[model samples]
Each structure stands twice: as structure tokens, then as C-alpha cells.
Target: MELWFTGTNAGMPIADRNVTSIVLRLAETRGEFWMFDCGEATQHRLLRTPLRITRLEKLFVTHLHGDHVFGIPGLLSSRSSLGATAPLQIYGPSGIRELIDSWMGITETHLGYPLSVCENTEGIVFEDGDYSVRCAKLDHRIECYGYRVEEKPRAGALLVDRLERAGIPPGPLYGQLKSGLDVELKDGRIIRSADVRGPAIPGRIVAVLGDTRPCAGAVRLSERADVLVHEATFGGNLADKAELYGHSTAEQAALTAREAGVSRLLLTHFSSRYGAEDIAELVQEARTLHPNTDAAVELTPYAIARARNES
Candidate 1:
């Protein structure tokens, strides 16, 4: 899996960065990418990267903040114009559906694809065989949320050599064995799949949070995740100011990742007052607590490698 930072600035746009937006590009995409947030001019940001709005299957809005959702209408319309016929599912806090409904209604924007808006609360909002998504309320000015994506564990690799050594040919019998069924051989012997297969491979976990301060919800949502994408909107020296504004400093974000025992911490949503040079200080502060930490750069794809134990 790869994480693409489309926007990483806080409050306003900087010369090099836009507001808060992150796209979770699955390496094994079933024809869709999951977007964490769509900030203002996010479609324009996608134009700079290899990502496309048409390929986005789901949009998870952290809050109704303009910097987090102002691009919804534009992105939707652009996808329609691009001849995307797939349905789009949007999940967010209450009033999100109404907000988009009003925006589209006022602008008289027409869309060809079907849109499904879901106002989410704390719990497992989405689940399927491949993945499950859960959300939790976070400390912010409004009803903000954090999401956790957990991929399902996969069956172990079939032991082709072991089966061949046992005089089992690779045919329909291999299929039955792979499906965890015992295959009866012509010699009146039974072969078990589990006896020959390797250990099951653990799935990956990803946590993505919107604008929020250091809180338990953040830790709960990000616990032991392979990648924890937390907003670090202030510098270490500005801890008091960050709390007053319901934001977290880079150091605090690092602390959260450490407490959650996450493998990697990606700090983003930096205040616009800081320039590119200032980001070094933020990242350094985070590294003081969590060594596996990095400040996210806009349009860069950060690869999420599987944890050692998971592998």
C-alpha cells in the first residue's frame, strides 16, 4: 500500500503545499482508491500527481471544514465530465450529506455517477471480506473523526512441492485442497491443506485522522497500525497554542504514535506560518519521541511496508 499526500498545509495554502488532503492508493486496488480527505482545490492537486478523481471509490471527510471538504463539488463534477460511471460513496459526520446536497443544488451541478452519502458515527461504518473500516470521534472544534482500515488476513501459500511429493498432481484436487477441504486420493489416503500450507499472512492496518488534538480517540483509532497518518498542525514550542486551537504539535503526534505502538508515523497538516525549511524542525521534534516518523510532503507517495511480525 502507498500513501499519497495531496495537501499537507493547515488553515491556508502555502506556495508548495495545499490544505489537508491524503489519498490512500492501494497497491492491489479492486478498481478504486480510498481518499482520506478532499480539501479545497484538491482536484487541481490530483492533476499534479498520477492520481485521478475518477478512480476514487470512497471519500472520507474528517469534518465539514472548508479546507477538508470544499473540493467535493468540483471533484464530483470533474469525475462526471471524465465519463466515470462508477458509484461514489462518501462517509462523514452529520450534516455532510446536506452540505453537499446544498452545494450541488445551489450550483445546479449535474453528475452522471451515483453518489451515496453516509453520515457516520463512532463504530464500524463499513466492512467487507477484503477490509473493514471503523471511525471514532476525536477532539476538534466540531464533530471530527478518525478512521481505521484493517485488511483481512489472507490464506497461506499452497505448498505445490509438498503436494507433488505426496503423489498429488496439480489439478482440480489442488483447488479442493486450497479451499481447506481434505482431498481423498485413489489410494484411500486423505490430504489436508493446512498440514501442507504455510502460516497465514497477517493483514495490514492503516489509521487516518482529520484535524484534531491529542486525545484517546486518536490513539484508539491508530493502535498498532502499520501507518498512522496524524495531523501535526503546530510546532513543539507552540503546544499551548496548538491545544487552544484543537490541534497537535509534531512532538505530540509522535507521542501518540509511540503510545499506540504504530510502526510508522506520518505527520501532516502543518501550519502555514512555517515554510519548507521550518518543516525540518517539526520532523526532528517528532523523531525525538518516535524514530519512525516523517513529515509528509505533498504529492509524494510513501510506501507502507509490512511489519516484520506481519511478514
Candidate 2:
């Protein structure tokens, strides 16, 4: 899996950063991409990367902030013009359907494919054969939410050496054994798949949070995650201002990551006040508190290798 940052600003666009948008790229599947928080000018960010807009399968909105969702209508319209025919599904908190309907209705924009909008509260929001996404309410100005995506565990690989030692040669029987099926040999003996298979590999977990303050929900959503993507709208010196604005600071994000026991911390949603050079100081401050903390940048993509022993 990988994470691509389309935007990483706090409230508005800065000279260096945009707003708040990200993409989750699944390595196991071809042409599959899921998005979180499509902020304004998101399409412009995609232009700089190799990502295909038509491959976007799902969009998860965290709140109703204009900086977070103003690009939706334009992106959706452009997808149709680009000859995309696949259906699109959007999941978010309440009022999402009304907002999209109002915009589409007012503009009289028609889509070539079906669009499914779901406004939900705390529970399993999305699930497919390989991934499952869950959400929880966050402490923000509005009814914001945090998402936890967990990929399903993969099957073990066939131990070719063990099979060869057992007098099994490479052939169609290898395929059957890999599929966890029993194979009957010409000698009237049956070999079970478990006898030559390694242990099943656990999947990786990624937690993404919207605009919110440091609260229990953040820790709960990020518990034991392989990567925790949280918003750090201010520095530690501005804790009061961050709390007043219903946002988190770099120190707060680091504390949450340490408390949640996450393996890595990715901090974004930076205020426009900080320049590119200043981001290093912010990252260093966070790392001082939590050793695994790092800041995100626009158009940067992070590839996460599959867990060890994965099939």
C-alpha cells in the first residue's frame, strides 16, 4: 500500500502546500485508488503525479469544510469528460448527499456513471474483498470523523522445498496445494495443503484523521496502526490557539501516536505560516516526543511494503 499527498495545508492554500487531500494506493490490486478529503485544487495536484483520476474507486470526506470538499464537483465532472464509465461511491458524515445533490442540481451537471453517496455515523463504512474501513466520531467544530483502513490477511506461500522433500514435483499439484486443497497422488496417498504451507501473514493497518483536536477518538482510531496520518495545524507553542480552532498541534499529534502505539506518524494539514524549511523544525519537534514522526508534503507518495511473510 502507498499514500500520496495531494494537499497538506491547514485552512487555505499556501505557496508551497495546497489544502487537505490524500490518496491510498493499494499495491495488491491494479488500477485501484481510494481518496480521503478532496480539498480545493485537488485535480491540479493529480496532474503532477502518475495517478489516473478515472481509477478512483472511493472517496471519504471527513467534514464539510470548503477547503476539504470544494473540488468534488469539478473532479467528478472531469471524470465523465475523460471517458470514465465506472461507478463511484462516496462516504461521509451527515449532509454529504444534500451538498452534492444541491451542487449537481444547481449546475445541471449530469454524470455518465452511477454515483452513490452515503452519509453515516460511527461504524463500518466501507468493505470489499481485500479491505475494510471503519470510522469514529472526532472532536472537531463539526461532526468530523476519523477512518481506519485494515487490509485482509493474505494466504501463506507454498513451501516448495518441503513439498519436494515429500516427493512432490512441480506441476498442477503445486497450484492445488497453494489453493489449500488436498491432492491425491498416483500412489493413492493424499497430501493436505497445511503440510506444506507457511503461516498466514497479517495485514497492514492505516489510520487517517480529519481536522480535530487531540482526543480519545484519535487514539482509538489509530490503535496499533502501521501508519497514523494526523493533522498538525500548529506548533506546540500554539497549543491554545490550536485548541480554540478545534485543531491539533505537532506535539499533540506526536503524543497521540505514542499513546496509540502506532509504528509510524505522518503529520500534515500544516498552517500556511510555516515555509518548507520550517517544516523540518516541526518534524524534529514531533520526533523529539515520538521518534517515528514525520511531516507530509504535497505530491509526495509513500509506498508501504507488505507485511513480512505475506503471500
Candidate 3:
């Protein structure tokens, strides 16, 4: 899996950064992208990357803030214009459908493909054959939410050496064996797949948080995640200001990562006042507590690796 920062500024746009937005690209699946928060100028940010707008299958909005949702309409329109026919599902806090409907109605824009919106709170919001998404409420100025996406474990590779040792030559039967299907040989011998199959490999887990303060919900959603994408809108020195504004500082985010036992921490939604050097400082502060911490920049992509199992 990989994460691309479409926008990283908080509240407003900056010269080098836009408001909050992220795209989680699943490398195991082809043409699959999950977006978190669609800030203003999000489509423009995609212009700099190789991401296809039509591949955006799921959108998770953290809140109803303008900076987090102003670009949704334009992106939907652009997808239609580009001849995308796949349905788009959006999950967010309450009032999301109203906002989308109002925007489409006011602009008289009609979509060619289906658009579904779910306004929910604190539960499993989405599930498919390969993945599941759960939500939990967070402490913020608005009714914000954090999402936990868990990928289902996949079937393990076939033990080809074991099969070969048993006088089984690689052939079409190999495919069937790998899928756990019993294969009959020309000698009328039955080869059970379980004898040569390996153990299943566990899938990845990613947690994404919107604008919010350090809270229990965030910790729960991010617990034991392979990758935790949390907002760091302020530096360590501004803990009081971050708490006052219902946002988190670098140190606060790091603490959440440590407490939640997340393997990696990605920090974004930076305040406009900080520059590149300041962002480095923020990352360093988080790293002091949580070694696997980094700050995100607009248009930068981060690949999520599986965590090593603890002994």
C-alpha cells in the first residue's frame, strides 16, 4: 500500500500546500485508490501525479469543513467528463448527502455514473470481499471521524518444492492445487492441496484521521495499524493552541501513535505558518517519541510496508 498527499495544509491553502487530502493506493489490487478528505484544489494536485481520478473508488470524509470537501464536486464532474462509469461511494459524518445534493443541484450538474453517500457514525461503514472499513467519532470542532481500513488475509503461495519432491511435475494442476482444489493424476492418485499449501499471509491495516484533537477514538481506530495517518496541525510548542483549536500537535500525535502501537506514523494537515524547515522540525519531534514518524508534503507518496511480527 502507498499514501499520496494531495493536500497538507490546515484550514486554508498555502503557497506550497493545499488543505487536507490523501489517497491510499493499494498495490496488491490494480486500479484501486481510497481517498481521505477532498480538500480544495484536490483535482489540481492530481495533475502533478500519475494517479487516475477515475480510479478513486472510495472517499472517506472526516468532517464537513469547507477545506476538507470543497473539491468533491469538481472531481466528480471531471470523472464524468473523462468517461468514467464506475460507481463512487462516499462515507462521512452526517449531512454529507445534503452537501453533495446541494452542490449538484445548484450547479445543475448531472453525473453519468452512480454516486452513493453514507452519513454514519461510530461503526463498520463499509465491507467488501477484500477489505473492511470501520469508523469512530473523534473530538473536533465538528463531528469528525477517523477510519480504520483492514485488508483481509490472502491465500498463501503453493509449496512448489514440496510438490516436486512428491514426483508432481508443474502443470495445469499446479494452478488448481494453489487454489486448494484436489487434483487427480494420470496414475489415478489423488493429491490433496492442503498437503502442499503454506500458511495464509495476513493483510495490511491502515488508519486515517481527519482534523481532530488527541482522543480515545483516534487511539482505538489506529491501534496496531500498519500505517497511521494522523493530522499534525501544530508543532510541539503549540500544544495549548492545538488543544484549544481541537487539533493536535506533533508531540500529541506521536503520543497517540505510541499508545496505539501503530507501526508507522504519517503526519499531515500542517498550519500555513510553517515552512519546509519547520515541517522537518515537526517530524523530528514526533520521531523522538515514535521512531517511525514522518511528515507528509503535498504530492508526495509514501509506501506502506508490513510490520515485522514481534517475538
lDDT of 2 by residue, 1-311 (tens): 89999999988887778899999988754677999989889988998998988988899999999989998999999888888899999999899999999999999999998899999779898888788999998999998999999988876889999988889999999999988899999999889999888997789899999999999999999998889999988888889999999999898899999999988899999988888777788899899888988898678888776654455
lDDT of 3 by residue, 1-311 (tens): 88999899988998888888899987754677989999999999998998999888889999999999999999999988998899999999899999999999999999989999999878999988888999999999989999999988766789989998889998898999988899988899899988888877777899999888989999999999999999999998898999899999998999999999999999999988899999999999999999999887668778876545411
Model 1: lDDT of residue 158:
86
Residue 205 lDDT in model 1? Answer: 93
> How close is every model to the real structure, measured as TM-score?
0.96, 0.96, 0.95
Candidate 1 lDDT, tens digit per residue, 1-311? 88999899988787888988899887664757899888889999999888777898999999988889888888999999999999999999999999999999999998999999999979999999988999999999999999999988777778999998998887998888877888889999989889878778888899999888899999999999999999988998999999998999999999999999999999999988898789889999999999989889888889878655754
What lDDT would candidate 3 get against the real structure? 0.90
With a 3 Å backbone cut-off (N, CA, C), the pairs that clash in candidate 2 are none
What's the true lDDT of residue 117 in model 1?
96
Q: Show the lowest summed lDDT stretch of 10 residues, model 3.
A: 302-311
TM match of model 3 to true structure? 0.95
Error of 2 at 171 (Å): 1.4
lDDT for predicted candidate 2 compared with the true structure: 0.90
For each candidate, the alpha-carbon lDDT, in order, equals 0.90, 0.90, 0.90
